[model samples]
Target: MTNVVLFSGFGSHGKDVNEDLFDRCPDLDSAAADILGYSIRDRLRADRGAGPLDSPSNQVAAFVVNAMKYHAHREDGLTPDIVMGRDLGEYNALEAAGVLDFGTGLRLVHLRAELVGNADGAMAAVLGLTPEEIRAVLRSAGLHGLVFTSLNTPYQSVLSGRPSDIARAEEILLRAGAYDVRPIAMGKPFHSPLLAAAAEKFRDALRGTTFGRPRIPVIANCTALPYRQEITAEVLARHMREPVRWHESIRWVADRFPQAVYTAVGDQRLLLKMLRQIFAESIGPGPTGATSRSPVRIPSY
Candidate 1:
């Protein structure tokens, strides 16, 4: 069976996830901590009580945790045929695909996080609303500033824009029969036009960096597909400014590799949960471990 490794972005949960990873991979963990100016364990523990970390520290801690898990997987002699990372996790996938070195990727992530964190915007999750429905809400509400950030599932989408616009959209969605409308604890809106400045800055920063074609196909969060050409500064820059077609990307992978074993990586099983939801909505529940359209199944790490 094809082996696919799915890396989660931010929002890694569980009390012991960071602790266990820190214990397992001390060296890389230490390096990451040094770069971030705080221990990931401390940060995670604080985040448990507080809300999510600001973009910079959040990206740094998540990247380190992802690296620790990835190293542990390699130690167990596990490898992947395909690697997919969502949002912040994309940097991890690039490292896995041999397109970027750990140090360089981490450095870039730090820079990206800083630029994005400094922006003035907000994001919120709208559940029980289809992509079209949400778009309609934005149009009907005249929320020109608000935009769909991520299509996490058939019935879930994220809206991002200025704080006022996002709040307005959230209220509109709630009144329109959304199951839930929750704010995303982030310093800046991601994957939205509000980040246009950050995207442009990041693109310029990427010009000085080096990148190679991935060893395996790496599906991008921005397009929900494999890179059409060489991944360049412009491509990554555009990614920062576009919506993440997560559901479409996962479905594409499932359809392309029907027999692939989709394994969620990192500290939690959020990615697996989302994948399962997507499969259920798209193809309906099938046999215990089978998707309706394919034998592919989402397995947790």
Candidate 2:
């Protein structure tokens, strides 16, 4: 029975895990305060009260929530065999698997947002269109700055590029029969080359940090493979300017662990929702002979 623990990226956090966690897990709460130089709980509250959280708020909240949840799950005797994270969520995954300590992870998260700053480009989700379709739309428009960044699910993909180009692409996609093309509220055009400077700085930060091998296996978002420890930092830094191959990452997990039960411990069940979509078709051995990923025994409990 493989237990794959999932953590989501920025912009997905809500008021899911907050003040309640301080009392439930005092140790974690204290650690957060000690490392962050203030109470993360207080930050969460203030950030929420301020209305929609910015990129920094979402990043902080996502990590804090997942870290607390990981510890709580441990106390409940639920240790993961594999830890996987999506996009920015990989920072917490590294911490969960012991590749990085709490202090390093939290500080890195903060630094990541700081370095990326506010992006000049924009990101938008084009639902009901495969990544391939979205790319075709961009190409037809002869847009060079805009690029597909995240493949969230088979049918949903996120694109990041110039705001004007994004607006133009939205119109084109809608006309092409896209179910919905909504803008994602983010300060950074994550996973896009526009942040090349930020990515380089992030790589410098990564080089300075010590990345040990994970106690529990951790699947990386960029390569959809286990972190090489020594090169994991490079992969993480590249993620800033490259696409998050999420669909492939999930497929990699399912193919390896047929009885895998994916448990999402983050802002919400974003990863699980994507997982269900990936497993939607009862994929199995076809008439050709070999089996594709499907009929997964994802426990419903």
Candidate 3:
């Protein structure tokens, strides 16, 4: 079976892999810590207080930690045929595909988080609602600010926009038989046109960074296809303001590789659940031969 490595976004769980990474690669440890605004160990030990992991520093830290775990797996001689990242996890995916070095990826994430920090919005998952259903509700309710953000599966889609709009939409969706309308633990409305200004600013910041051609087939969240075009600053910036077409991306994988193992590289099974949902929604028993698994948590260094 073909092996594919997937990654989830920030605000997920992490392991104490920093100590070992520092011991083995001090220079890299220092650089990662500097970019993250604290020792990797310190942030991991910070308060578990919730609400929006949108801060540039927190985003950078998450990226660094995930990147470390990915590298640890690589050092152990596991290579992926294709790497996919959801939202912020894209940076780690790029790093894994040899498109960017660890430090470079963290730096780019720092800039992205900074650009996104000024925005004030909320995100929520609208379960048991089709994209068309959600769009119809948005139109009928005249909730202009509410926007469809990420499409996790046919039954699950994330909505982002003004907090009040989201709240009102939640009530409407519930009345319309939505399985659940749960708020995401985030402060900013990401992957929506509301962040178009942030996307423009991020474009400027990303131009100064280096993005190499991927060594492997790196699926893009925007297009749900391989990274065939030039990996430009605009392309990366668009992710901030565009929906993460995760369902399509996963479908692409399933169609291409009938016998494949899908693994999430994080401490949470969030992405794994989404993968299952996508498969569940497929027509006619849906890729019964495909395999899905929990996040592969790499041991500390």
Candidate 4:
């Protein structure tokens, strides 16, 4: 049987995915190079030298979605039994699933980054804390602006809000017997009400966009469920400002694909680490273990 694979990450571009795929199939480098162009190569190199190019999700989505199409055209088609994403990665999965065309998906992601990039905010990883404990701390501190942006795993979650509020919330979480809280380097607060304006702008952008029923199942960030045919661009637009239900979505994947191998495609291996932490006992040893693949860092193509 073909080993089922589950792919996910935040805002990792096509070049990234292509690079990862290339590692598995080295002879495809020329074809990948041809499709990605010189600009992509330069960008990828630069990204490697410096840190990750913040929010390349849209560009990556456009490339990978199209690359899959190109592969489909060539008969050496790319297909995954299940595809999913978290936050910006959701757009990638949407494109892979054929819910949103490449152009529309990329456009939406770019606009999303621009809109959310302006806000002053902060996010932090709260390790060794349950979601309920984190929520209780936020509530007790009267920090109304904070939101639990990511439920990555049972012991790990991300909290996002205005910088001041997040700082305060960090203290509260630490005091409540949490292991540690460290700030994330993201520029804006995502998956919170703070990005409501951006969501509206995204909704407007969606009007001009077209979406077809997906060829594969697409797990949405907001709902963490397989998208129904009735879900429109407007519904996806609303996801921009809403919290990502990553934990539930991952649970869905685990329950559905008990024997599947998960490969997290993106710059940072954050999602991969979380998966290991969450599914520790269930996975076996070695790289191909139920949870074994090393975090694949796709060169920014």
Candidate 5:
């Protein structure tokens, strides 16, 4: 059987990778850079000479996607059977699957970051609480501002809201029998309506961009389904303001690709670690006869 490899590209980390790969593979780098430059220049002309800050997030995504494609093509030789991503990583996965072209995906990513950056609230990771239980606690506490950002696993979830709302939700979860409620280091509440403006801006931007069917399957964060031909920039735009169905996405992957080897292609290995915990029994001893550490770095093929 052909070994299936999964690649979830990096977020901010991809910026550096783009530079590094440019030095190693000039032709690939040039091709990727040309695409990125065209995207930026077009944006500038449309906006009437706005600087990078006006659309920094999309610019970053464009750069990252180019770099990721370069790396994947250079190392893997052929596209993998499946690709997935979480939060910002989803854009990278979309690029890999050929759903969103490099420029468009990058543009969305840029909007996502800026929108997320504008929020002044906080987020936290709550462990040992089922989704039902957490929802019950939120309801009981009357915490109106809180949003569940990630369904990471059966017992682990990430919550986002105003600082006070988050604190209240945390207390309620702990009081309702959660094992741990810890704050995440991230400064903003993502996957919430708090970034509605950003999502709207992205929607406008998407009006001009085009999308094609994917060459490989892409698991979407909002729907947790394979990318369909019907998927439009409008649907992707809404994903910006919707919570990530991470648990469902993972279950989809596990159910569909039982024999595939999963790898998280980003700076943080948290996604891989979570996958191991969720599918501990499914994973077997490798050639080294040991459980693997997550966040496997993609090497040059």
Candidate 6:
């Protein structure tokens, strides 16, 4: 039974989130307090990373959610053969695959917030256009500052740049036949060169942290491949200062694990939805887990 588990970027739907889910588990609850503070559930649910650190609320909350849910699944004796995540979800994959411990992951995310999260950069999604198309438009518009942050789909590109450049890119994209040029939910140039300086410092944190070998392969968004155990920290740090090759990573997994069953955990509906689309486009419609034609099933977590 090949099971590849996935983690979503940003976060999952907050509707079914259990504010007290961690309270039922001692370790998970304690981890929450380590970075989330008292009233962990309530504070996380509130998205007010307004504690002493004041990290980005959305990012910290998503990290907590992914970690909590992964541990819950582990407590139930569920383990996946392959683990992967998009954007911030990479930490979830690392922790799940035994790379970083839970508490350490939390602290790293907090540190990431301090270093990489800034008001100077912004992110937005340009829908109904390919990365190449977006680049062509950028070239035409002379907006060299904007960069492809994440290639979520063949036709969808997440872009990041300065606030002014993002505004200009949006206007130019709208005028250049883009179906929609909307700002990402929590707009920031997350995985773009704009974060290089800060991400370089975050690299020091990654190197300082202890990294264990993964029990299962953990695909990284930065390279769209399994992370090398020896250079795991460097690869993770690069995720902040590089474009996310999400489309390629998903496809690589599907090709590698033909007939593999995909199992999504935590708040992964968005990622799964993108997976379906990715498969539909690359391999044609129908079941979209393994290869285009491989029989696929999404087993319940």
Clashing pairs in 4: 13-60, 14-60
Q: Best lDDT goes to which candidate?
A: 1
Task: Quote each prediction's TM-score.
Answer: 0.89, 0.90, 0.89, 0.76, 0.76, 0.89
Q: What is the lDDT of residue 32 in candidate 1?
A: 73
lDDT of 5 by residue, 163-256 (tens): 8888778778888899999997655767778778878877787787777787878878888888776766766776877888877887786666
Candidates' C-alpha lDDT? 0.77, 0.77, 0.77, 0.64, 0.64, 0.76
Q: Candidate 3 — which residues are off by over 4 angstroms?
A: 13-27, 48-54, 283-301
Looking at candidate 3, the ten consecutive residues that score lowest on lDDT are: 292-301
Tell how far residue 137 is off in model 1, in angstroms: 2.3
Candidate 6: Cα lDDT at 197: 87
TM-score of 3: 0.89
Candidate No. with top TM-score: 2
The parts of candidate 6 lying over 4 Å away from their true place are 11-15, 45-55, 286-301
Q: How much is the lDDT of residue 266 in candidate 3?
A: 68
Q: What is the alpha-carbon lDDT for the whole of candidate 5?
A: 0.64
Residue lDDT tens for model 4, 1-301: 1222234544444444445444443333344445445344446656666767665443443344434433332244334666677666677677667787555655566677778777667888899888888888888889887888778778888888888888888878888989999898765778878788878887887787778887767777788788875776766776877777777776676666665555444543556666666665333332334444432222222
Model 5 regions lying over 4 Å from their true place = 1-22, 25-66, 69-74, 281-301
Which residue window of length 10 is worst by lDDT in model 2? 292-301
Better of 2 and 4 by lDDT: 2
lDDT, candidate 6, residue 51?
29
List ranges where model 4 is wrong by over 4 Å: 1-7, 11-38, 50-78, 281-301
Winner on TM-score between 2 and 5 is: 2
Clashing pairs in 5: 57-110, 58-110, 61-106, 62-106, 75-301
